[model samples]
Target: EVKGDGRAEDAYLLATPYNRRVAERLAGAELRLDEPPPPAAATALPNIFALYEENIGAITPLIADELKDAEERYPPQWIEAAFREAVSLNKRSWRYIHSILRRWEAEGPDYEEAGRDPEADWLERRYARGKRGAGRLR
Candidate 1:
């Protein structure tokens, strides 16, 4: 019987000895597993700047294309600075830098003026508080 979750509660009800015979005949065909096992390097590894640079170098063309129209949309210096920061901090968090770049591209002129929005502001505040608390404990 099929359940609300789309699973057959009594799957054995549909299975029979005859099903085994049919399966045996088809078993001779190469049956690749639907899902492959996880890669050997599935676990998180130490972040290395060299490895990060290699990946960034491979995607440089895409980054260049994204910045091609930046001069027309934003101040040249601000755009250059953002790109420089993104490259310099690539090893720290490329995804975060990519998100910032996307926001900058979408916001256009307002992007540079925003100056590290609420999320960054909150992080800075929290970090400052932590430092103050550590000093008090010392």
Candidate 2:
């Protein structure tokens, strides 16, 4: 039996744990189980959009949509690291950053920069003309 008499006790009861269920029961409502809250890690992640805006350039609506898609497809840490890598490489294009994310997804990330330029390799593969042409497009 609840001790509330529709006065301060009622207010106190509403303020306490289990009070919501007690009030609902008093009102002749069915008991419903509470859903668990989201994980702490989810809340603790840094806002990738904010990080991008700060480190990269301003986001257009198209870029915003792409960012949303990337956020869903990639981990927050990967996105942050991609941004940092783009800045370090002085390649400030979203296409460049997005390519990094895609390569990381496909080939797994290389944590050690170690004098390796994956971007250069990717670009060479993408635009390499012919053996005779070398750097020139066929």
Candidate 3:
């Protein structure tokens, strides 16, 4: 059972062990909680969204945090495109997000600097499509 007085700090402390660092990162960045994309948005591409959430869930409790934090720094369209691409390539891991954010923190939250394309080799393996007799991606 979760016992808390409904304080933000208390909630942060209660985050899953794997997610504590993520929480700290978001908090340190001065993020305020905010809502995430609708469930339907994610349902269309679970692998993609799962990949996106994996990174977000690592550092922040909710999507709102990043949105709120970046509101002043990044344009909504840029964030949207970045999010969509990140989900598509499945590069939304903790490490990847950290790298992306570190650049943002240093240079500024510019989408051009944050761009990362999925590696062709990784894509071939990730889907393993049309590869007969392939037990798993190489």
Candidate 4:
């Protein structure tokens, strides 16, 4: 449900087996979307929490290399330094940089969870087609 302040929450999400699992995962993520993202995820397997945190507003800046050989390379500090250099040079695009960061950060889950169970993406994947091309489930 959308909260009074306009932030969205699951409301009564733990109702079904699948929803319960999703809710459990969201809960376990310890997400703090109200602040900036950490340099890395908390757990050894980063991005589970990192990506979730960015879903709201938290973000960590980085300069990611374009995927070559079909492989993505996210250099943790390079983006920061690049942006820092741009700012140091008085480049007036830091805001644009952040906007790009937010957009890319939002895609983190898709990158992190490629080829995993689609059911895990139910809540946000509203209107997604079912196996039989049924109507939206979430």
- TM-scores for all predictions: 0.27, 0.51, 0.29, 0.18
- Screening candidate 3 with a backbone cut-off below 3 angstroms (N, C-alpha, C), the clashing residue pairs are 22-59, 34-64
Judge candidate 1 against the unseen true structure and give its global Cα lDDT, from 0 to 1.
0.49
Model 1: per-residue Cα lDDT at residue 62: 53
lDDT at 56, model 2? 75
- Model 4, global lDDT: 0.42
Error of 4 at 90 (Å): 1.1
The residue ranges of model 1 lying beyond 4 angstroms of the native Cα positions read 1-55, 58-61, 87-98, 101-138
Top TM-score hit: 2
Q: How far does residue 87 in candidate 4 sit from its true spot (Å)?
A: 0.4
Candidate 3: tens digits of C-alpha lDDT, residues 1-52: 1222343434435668768776656554443345465566433333323444
Q: How close to the true structure is residue 13 of candidate 4, measured as C-alpha lDDT?
A: 57
What is model 1's C-alpha RMSD? 17.2
lDDT of 2 by residue, 6-86 (tens): 322222364565877766666643322243665676456567778678877698999999989999999888888888788
Question: Model 4, 1-138: lDDT tens per residue?
Answer: 323333545456547899877766666454444566658755533332232233323433432222121123444443443343334434435344354345555654232344744344443454477555677565
Q: Could you tell me how far off, in angstroms, the CA of residue 110 lies in candidate 3 after the best superposition?
A: 9.8
Report lDDT (CA) for all predictions.
Answer: 0.49, 0.73, 0.51, 0.42
